[model samples]
Target: MDQYKYIVVEGNIGSGKTSLAKMISQEHDRELILEEFADNTFLPQFYNQPERYAFPLELSFLAARYHQLKKKLTALPLKTFVSDYLFDKSLLFAKVNLKEEEFGLYRTFFELLERDIPKPDLIIYLDKDIAKLQANIEKRGRPFEKDISNTYLENIQIGYEKILSDSGLNVLKINSGELDFVKNESHFKKVINRILTY
Candidate 1:
């Protein structure tokens, strides 16, 4: 944790990546970068009508993520930081949500923007089963996320597995289904120990 200047906690929707990232940043006294998903106007529309909104939703997200990271990562007296998302998460979701031709075009834009962004020194991937993920999502009670199907979540999980496996980045995968770091002090300590030891 001390050696890495930039760390990312990544996982599917409702897998508690944000919560874990926040806790780590607060505890470690590092800067925190959380994804601004709620700011995306296309998100709700995309949920209801994916075919009509997926491209724009993804494009908006790409631009937002790039701009946010560029601004935050550049405005430095450079302290170590933890973010809840990896920049390539855009590509992962785009691959799952877009058509073949749309994805090709999206990938071009992504590649162009990605070269300029600094990659995380380490990525902490939280892996949870579909049932657990769904329960968490329901617990969170975000209306836009209420309709997310198990199949969709399963696809995202598969995408994460494939992407992380092929990515040359340093990654730590955690089985988070049984861990409640947000509430249980022991669980939180276990997670912190893993990161510190890794």
Candidate 2:
């Protein structure tokens, strides 16, 4: 925690990044930066009809993230920052879910926007099997997420794997199929130890 200034935990929908990020922040006594997914106006619509709302949803997130990071940079030093999501991964999900033409345009805009942002010092990527991811999503009981399909989750998992593999960033991959760090203190402590030791 002292050596690394910024840490990020990344994963697909219902992959438990937020929970892990919260745990890490508490363990290290660092400030937390959670994504405001519930505030996304297009999120529910995007989930219901991805083709129609994908670009708008992605764009909203990109802008929100950019503004949040900018504010953090201006207000705080980068010595103890932990975020649940990476800015670039927003584009990854968008590209994977959007149509070809929409994706092309989105990528062009993303390239233009990403240059202004600072990258995280490390990324902890949680990879869960599709079934587990779907199960977790259901357990969370988000009204908008109820209609998500297994195929969509599968595509997102593939996208995350490909990005993390070639990211040119330090990544710690965790098998998250059965890791319930939130309610289980011992398992959470074990994971925290690994993160600190690394």
Candidate 3:
């Protein structure tokens, strides 16, 4: 378990990634690094008008992820770190949100910033069905997310899977539609045990 100095929990927008990461960090006493999604000024606007705000929103997220991860990972004495998101999530979202020409421009900057990111030792990907995901999203009751469609969520799901397949990192992909890691102790324990044994 010590071999996994850095671990990342990933999933679609409404997946239980943040909840799992929080629990793991609290129970296992690992350093937690959560993505500052609400801080992105363009996120609400992007949700309302993706075409107009997509580029800036993506760029903002890219810069934020790079800056936060670089600052926290390098300067902190975090032996075991659990983050809600992977750094390359910027690229994944950008690929989906940006147009071809815009993505080409974004990719150039992403590659340069990506070279500086320290890779995670293991990734726990929550693979949930779209129906469960939408339910979870609705339960959260974020206004910006209310407009999110199942098709959009599916696209993000596909994007996440594609990246995981190509990431070449030690990954544990779990079918998480039935697991309630946030409220169920047994389920959370199972997830924690899996990561530790990995």
The segments of candidate 2 whose C-alpha lies over 4 angstroms from its true place after superposition are none
Better of 2 and 3 by lDDT: 3
Q: Arrange candidates by TM-score, highest first: which order?
A: 1, 3, 2
Please write out the lDDT profile of model 3 over residues 51-164, one tens digit for every residue: 999999999889999999998888885568999999988989999999999999999999999988899999999999999988998999999999898888888989999998
Residue-level lDDT for 117 in candidate 3: 88
lDDT of 1 by residue, 1-198 (tens): 789999999999999999999999999999999999998999999999999999999999999999989888888646888999999999999999999999999999999999989988999999999999999999999999999999999999999999998899999999999999999989999998998898
Judging by TM-score, tell me the better candidate of 1 and 2: 1
Question: What are the Cα lDDT values of the candidates?
Answer: 0.95, 0.85, 0.90
Residues 76-163, model 2: lDDT tens digits: 8745888999888877788777888988888888888888778888898888888888889899999998988888788888888888
TM-score of 1: 0.98
Which residue pairs collide, candidate 1? none
Is 1 or 3 the stronger prediction by TM-score?
1
User: What TM-scores do the predictions have?
Assistant: 0.98, 0.94, 0.97
Models, CA RMSD each: 0.7, 1.3, 1.0
Worst ten in a row by lDDT for model 2: 70-79
